[model samples]
Target: MDKRNQSTVTEFLLLGFGDLHNFKILVFTLFMTVHIMALTSNVLVIVLVGVTQSLHSPMYFFLSQLSLCEIVFTSNIVPTMLWLILVGHGKVSVAQCLYQFYFLGAPVIAQCLLLAAMSFDRHVAICRPLHYVTIMTFTNQLQMVTSCWFVGFTLTFFIYIFLRKLRFCDLNTINHFFCDVAPLLRLSCSSTTSVELTTAMVSFLVILSPFIFIVATYISIIHTILKIPSTSGRHKAFSTCSSHLIIVCTYYGTLSSIYIVPPRDNSINMNKGLSVLYTLVTPLFNPLIYCLRNQDIRNAVYKYIQSFRRRKVVL
Candidate 1:
């Protein structure tokens, strides 16, 4: 730890999937396709929610926010990943790496809070139908969304501050595709105990707390659904929040595997694989699941397509 022995690392070399040299082209094509599809789907969701009057409920509002997060989340990391795959390894300045971490981390934390807020929205709609309108006012929705973004960025800023304090020595190779905290910490010659501890505490608050809230909210939702006297009523109630539930499961399942679970001796590759699930696959599937399962989204999409077709015919 002596200053005399330390060499400043101005840039980092990301060793992104370089071992897969045989599948370089395949990996590049796959990542590019997923990135484009995730972006397109999230954008479509945002557009449909914005333009379609019938889709302007509190639920759809949160869905639009979630899509926006997905767009930011995937775009921040995937392009760099694609470049790394193509080049075998990519060089990035220390500042650029920290910026990447902030952008990527903020949206992830935002999405966690957003999902929790969405669960609360579903809870109000289902458990207190009569008060749903009064409870989920436009002002309230804005407050919830604002709080999510505010807390997300604020929490990540602290982590960024901690990261900036740690000095990297001569070793500047990041084993992962992106500037993830784990990889950067691995390369740092300075002590990372404080950074690791702060990250752990923040993860517990952002990830685990929201997940626990979502679970408790769903339990209440299910209890209310089961009490419905008519079978059709129960089915209808379940359908309303089912899409969000699916997304919650998929998002949290992959996320917990990577962050919550302890890493094993050969867990780097496994972590990368799990990272793909949450970062790439989850975003790609979110809008698809919602559109397929939610009647309102489908109707809005169908109506838009019909309108487009009619305009084409007129032209």
Candidate 2:
């Protein structure tokens, strides 16, 4: 093939877990189980929030948005992976790969920012209780959710511009399961240093900035909690923030390890494991955390179940 022809790759082969060929069925089963579970849990949260009038608060509103994002995020990547595992080989067109990357990137960014917004919500509720209702009204919550989605979708253009310019040459096989930025960059024949640096910088700014803001907001929340004279008041304040804190810790901790911190090994397998943590595990856990830990959510869910039973009996 001529150099020009070699540089042009119309499609990409998703080389997903080629080493696991012997256990492909096992892998497929595991992934399918997790994917189904993640989807079911997140969707349940969304439905519960929608139907339960008591859950119409700003916090639950954000939780529902997060659940929706999780649904979209996992759907974009997991089904393709299942198909590839079942069929043995999967080819994705250049356009398809780019769209996959865009879809994945946008929600991940939006979720990060949403976590920050959730933290700010907690901050307002705890530290500035008197002004919480005024500050985090439905209109403000809607604007915040919209802003997170908008910024996440808009920011992809920066990385995608450079990503689109890269020539694949003869390398058209994506090492990882999905069309992740790191794996895609590895397949490019050209030097991706600038693109890599740009990506790293963008990720740091987008992720770390919100993370820092969340930390500061929590500090203020903590300070306020300590000042509360009654133990019950302090417990109430802590309970409100705990789920968000756990999520922040899990999401950002895995995220920073993958993107922000210096990588210990840039191996495909290593990245795959880290990717699973954030992409699959985190989404699965979010709804479980909220439903199990938060008394309000649990009560609402219980009430919903009772109502459902009562309606079924009547019918």
> What stretches of model 1 exceed 4 Å from their correct place?
none
lDDT of 1 by residue, 189-284 (tens): 889999999999999999999999999999999999999999999999999888989999998888889878988879988888888777789999
- Give the Cα error of residue 47 in candidate 2, in Å: 1.7
Indicate which candidate wins on TM-score: 1
Residue-level lDDT of model 2, residues 1-315, one tens digit each, is 566666578899987766566788898899889889999999999898898888889999999999999998999998888887787778999888988999998898999999999999999988888999899989999999999999888887778888898888777887667887877787888779878887877797679999999999998999999999999999988988999999999988988877776655545578778887777788899999999998878898788789989999999
Cα shift from native, residue 289, model 2 (Å): 0.1
User: What is the C-alpha local distance difference test score of each model?
Assistant: 0.92, 0.87
Clashing pairs in 1: none
lDDT over C-alpha atoms for residue 123 of model 2: 91
* Top candidate (lDDT): 1
Root mean square deviation (Cα) for candidate 2 = 2.0
TM-scores, all candidates, are 0.97, 0.93
- Runs of candidate 2 with Cα error greater than 4 angstroms are 1-7, 19-22, 191-194, 264-266
